[model samples]
Target: MHLSIIAGSSGLVGNNILNQLCEDNHNVIAINRKPISGLHPKTTELVIDFESFLIDGSLPACNHAFICLGTTMKIAGNKNNFRRVDFDYSLDIAKKAFESGAKKLTLISSGGADSSSKNFYLRVKGELEDAIINIGFESVNIFRPGFLTGAGGRKRATSEKIFMKLAKFLDLILIGSARKYRSINAEVLARKMVSTLKSKPGVNYYYYDDFIK
Candidate 1:
């Protein structure tokens, strides 16, 4: 039996991936701080304090794990809090998952993510990507989507909404290499991630163009 574990199952992309996995009849373990509303035969909800996840003794062995947990500085309230979620919590979970026998791990990252970036958010994401890669999963697929559009009751700041709207409108005009910078829907991203499970053992990177494909 192939089991899949998803962190941040309550978020937009995570929720979509959880539902997609269930629909594919894959057994899934959903990890979240709070309960996610959904009922599926192959779904197991694991609610826990992310900070103490190392000692939780509840992690189930899985074939693959998806890291979807993320937050912004505004919502996290401070730079320290933001780094805790985006960097500390994610890397810790990745390490724990790696030790749990998950052969493949997929990360939902962002475009322009660079550990040496001047932007705080991008730098944090880049750092997490680097750390996870070093964990040495048999297969590590990093998806760097530009802007995401989807419905999951996820709250977005005014500026974010404006940017999303602009990206959505501009998506139609983006072609060829330009598509790599276009906005992609959350559901689409989830579907692609699941579909790519058969990928060979190695680290792979996907950008906006890859998302459209």
Candidate 2:
């Protein structure tokens, strides 16, 4: 299938998806803020600022879109900036993809995403999920993986690094409630997202345990 991906290209998940899509001979359009080195033959790269990228007939006709865009507080250095990457940028791409005739969208969201959650990060994720659903795609898939595993680009903040390490151990102990804590290999998550599109559609939401299994 022809695909367009946003965000996470520099991150573990995005990079894995890009590689796998190219390997499978799927036509891919990768959008990023900076140039991505070593893309595959089937891949086309676009470097542009997400906030100001105007849709002036550059996007290809696509069947599916994957939104892997995200940022942390440390990377963004501010809550508002973080939200811009995590929420606003994602929404922008989704809207443009829909406008360009893409019928399916898959979003990489966190496990605790809840529109009514008290936690800021999860709440923002939930709000984005809700907003995307309201945008009315023909098919939507929301993947909520746990602590992602695999290496790419730069490491996250020290605290996040420590948490991911600790979570790996705890994942073995907690089974269900902490299922979201289970660490998922980035490649596995990407494969699952792409494979799901082949099935009959509705809004399919996969939690961490569901993804790992």
Candidate 3:
């Protein structure tokens, strides 16, 4: 199947997803701000500034689209900039892909996404999910994985890095609570996302454990 991916070549999830899609023999187009290196023949990279990317009627036809664009506040160094990358850029790509005849959309959200959440990160993610749902896609799969374990171009803050190290032990005990913190390998999430796209068409939401399961 033909697939279009936005932001799956930089972060751990996106990079793994892109590689898996290529291995599956699917035609994949990767859109990002910078060129991706060492991709398979089935993969094509499109580099353009996200802030001024013009869909302008020029996009490859695809059956599915994946939105994996995200950034942390530390990396962005500004809340607004972080939101722009994590929310605005993702929405823009989804809107454009939908307009370009893509039907299925898979998004990688956070674990505690809630529109009314007190946490800024989760609130933003929740808001983005709501906005995407309102955009009217035929099928939407939202995967919320916790403490992603993978290597990426972006690095976590020192505090988050320490928290992740500690969470490794806690994750074993907090297996089934709403506040349960589970860590999923980025490769695992990537495979699941692709599998979901290939399997069926439905509006599905998966939390942290569910993603790995």
Model 2 residue 154 lDDT?
A: 66
Give the Cα-based TM-score of candidate 3 against the true structure.
0.90
Ranking by TM-score: 1, 2, 3
Candidate 1 lDDT tens digits, 31-137: 88888665587899888887777556446788888999998777999989999998887888788888889999999999889999999999999999999999989
**TM-score-best of 1 and 3:** 1
Predicted model with the maximum lDDT: 1
Mind giving the per-residue lDDT tens digits that candidate 3 earns over 115-165?
899998999999999999988888899988788876665667788678767
**Which of the two, 1 or 3, has more lDDT?**
1
Please give the distance, in angstroms, between residue 194's alpha carbon in candidate 2 and its true position after superposition.
1.7
TM-score of model number 1? 0.92
Per-residue lDDT for 1-213 in model 2, tens only? 456654557677888888878777887888888887778888888787765664343456777788899987877999899888899888878887788788889999998899899998999999999999888888899998877876775667777678767877878886858766578878888888777557456788887756656
Q: What's the lDDT for candidate 3?
A: 0.80
Model 2, global lDDT: 0.80
Location of the lowest summed lDDT over 10 successive residues in candidate 3: 51-60
What candidate 1 gets wrong by more than 4 Å, as runs, is: 54-58, 172-178
